[model samples]
Target: MGRTIFLLISVVLVAYYVYIPLPDAIEEPWTIGRKAAIVKIGTDLASFGELLGISHFMETMQLLMKFQEVPPTSDENVTVMETNFNSIPVRIYIPKRKSMTRRRGLFYIHGGGWCLGSAALLTYDTLSRWTAHKLDAVVVSTDYGLAPKHHFPRQFEDVYRSLRWFLQEDVLEKYGVDPKRVGVSGDSSGGNLAAAVTQQLIQDPDVKIKLKVQALIYPALQALDTNVPSYQEGSHFPMLTRSLMVRFWSEYFTTDQGLEKAMLLNEHVPMESSHLLQFVNWSSLLPERYKKSHIYKNPTPGSSELAQKYPGFIDVKACPLLANDNILRQLPLTYIITCQYDVLRDDGLMYVKRLQNVGVHVTHHHIEDGFHGAFAFPGLRLSERMQNQYLSWLIKNL
Candidate 1:
């Protein structure tokens, strides 16, 4: 019986090792291949759970990501606190050294496509700790609700609420934070939330304080066109694929499986919302150098029925790239990072162009050899280089 059980377990393990294949076309820097294989296996396991009917993909992925969380390391340079603000959970990291003046404050949002990350995760915790220590700033990382369970707008609301709470005079004074030095930063979907929040705050009548800076790391700024150069060229890259990204968008916006398929084909935008596509038209928005050989093609008109059913697809809050020039010009100093091997690369590029066109102070960094998820891993040489660039920017600007 023991031998039979062992054989069954070994067979299943072998099948997974074979079934979840790594990226076929590996770029230079073997570390990318290693990271790709790890991500592939991790993501595939979540999909496998859903296929087996054990749980939903998001739920499975959330569980898998939970295992990756590590308790905050006991460091003397920074103090960590887990608490709630405005009923929204948050993890705070503070530098231990006494400061003569108010220090800068950063509100951080974790990225997992809005469904698979936590502030407690090692990736996020390490980042918050480093930002607190290196910048000598207070960092508050929000634990926003996940999707397919909480849905769209809920994640945004959580972030906005926590940030508002942190921005209050009492809260900032307690943390010894300077009102003029606060900044917001996040990566990927968290970047989307950061951008959206920044835009909303710019126009918000209730917001008394203007943001000083917004640092976005490979942010997913738009959901309109998936046929852009990066999407077409880097779709098959292991870190983040076009199909998987559309699915993540669908999961965040709605539960309809059909809508997800339509989105993948770039058919969720109806004629009514077609006007908004101009903002995301990569051919016009992207620089010639970034366009390369990819030709632009107009997307087919989408189903009106699906469009009516899911209106969030066209909402500016969900796609910050749709914001007009007036709003763009009013935005604070912005820093954007784009990775070459990422499907969402153009999102950052176009945003940079739009911000610059409107006379907004902008700093843009394009990493030729970088991929989407590398910055989250921290220890890799590539990630470290990107981290140094980010820290350098904060030191100079923040």
Candidate 2:
């Protein structure tokens, strides 16, 4: 059965890669051993599910990817619990030791492109527990609604509700959490939510706890800019290819037909949005260091119909990069983590520039040799280092 599954996956991967080859610019330029590991794990999971003849592929994929999280154990210093914020489910991590005073609080959202991934998965379990133990803070991660099923604004609403619970429920007081020291963080799509949720917190006049900060790990902040340096540079990099990202967005937003392909070509921007381009258009704003050797392209005109069909694509709340200066100015001091080989690297960089421009305190750490989703593999030394650095800053700031 194992051998059969392997052969089946090999055929599928070969077919996909061959029939839909990437531009040479993206496909033949670089090499890395870690890329093979990502492919192997993902294909193997799919193969295993197909071999088992499982009717539910989504569940199988979630289970396999979860094998990627940090392994939970008898960490006597930390205890884990399951709870809910209104209608949304959440997993909480508490340090076993009694605090001398109120502990800092962190609410996390896990990333699976808004289609897959779980806050309760062992991978996130490992991350959350480590955070709780290392920072000596309480951690909460939400299982926000997934796409194509629960739909748009649903995931956002769930995250907002969960964060509000942190304050309204006096959750901090009950758990001895520091009222003014609470913050939010997420990886990938979760990072996207964390950003939006922070904005929501900032705008709510009645918000009880002051959200002091946000930490984003290679977040997917915008769908409007496809030709950004990292998008091009990491287009062919392992794990997150340009095409796969489009698929993720398509499912998440259920965008109009043929829009995904246009998005990849950098022609997806609507004419109505032409005025906003000068701000987010990477060619003008990106530093020389970020552009590297690749030349930038002008966004060719796309259909106004597309713009009409999915105006939400340009909404500041949906794509935070499109946010106006006023909104950007109000964001809290933030920490953004970027990886050299990740497609979304430029997204993080672009946001860093925006944050700094508005004089929002911004601390960014770019890993010299890291790939997208590198932190998911807890065994890697680089992954461990990444978490430590991020946690160090988070703990200090909180």
Off by more than 4 A, model 1: 1-28, 72-74
Q: Write the per-residue lDDT of candidate 1 for residues 1-398, one digit (tens) a residue.
A: 99999999999866654443334442344555555666778778888888898889888778877888977565899989888999999999989999999999999988889888999998899889988999999999998888889877888889998888898888999999999999999999999999999998888777686679999999999888877889888887677899889888888888889889888887778888899988998888898999888888888888999878777778888889999999999999899999888999999999999999999999999988788987777558778888889989987888
- lDDT for each residue of candidate 2 in 62-179, tens digit (9 for 90 to 100): 6666676543343788887777887788888889998788898999999988778887677788888889999999998888887657656777888889889887646778877888
Residue 37 C-alpha lDDT in model 2? 50
Query: What is the clash count for each candidate, in the order shown?
Result: 0, 1
Best by lDDT: 1
For model 1, the run of ten residues with the poorest summed lDDT: 19-28
Q: How close is every model to the real structure, measured as TM-score?
A: 0.93, 0.85
Distance from true location, Cα of 151 in model 1, Å:
1.2
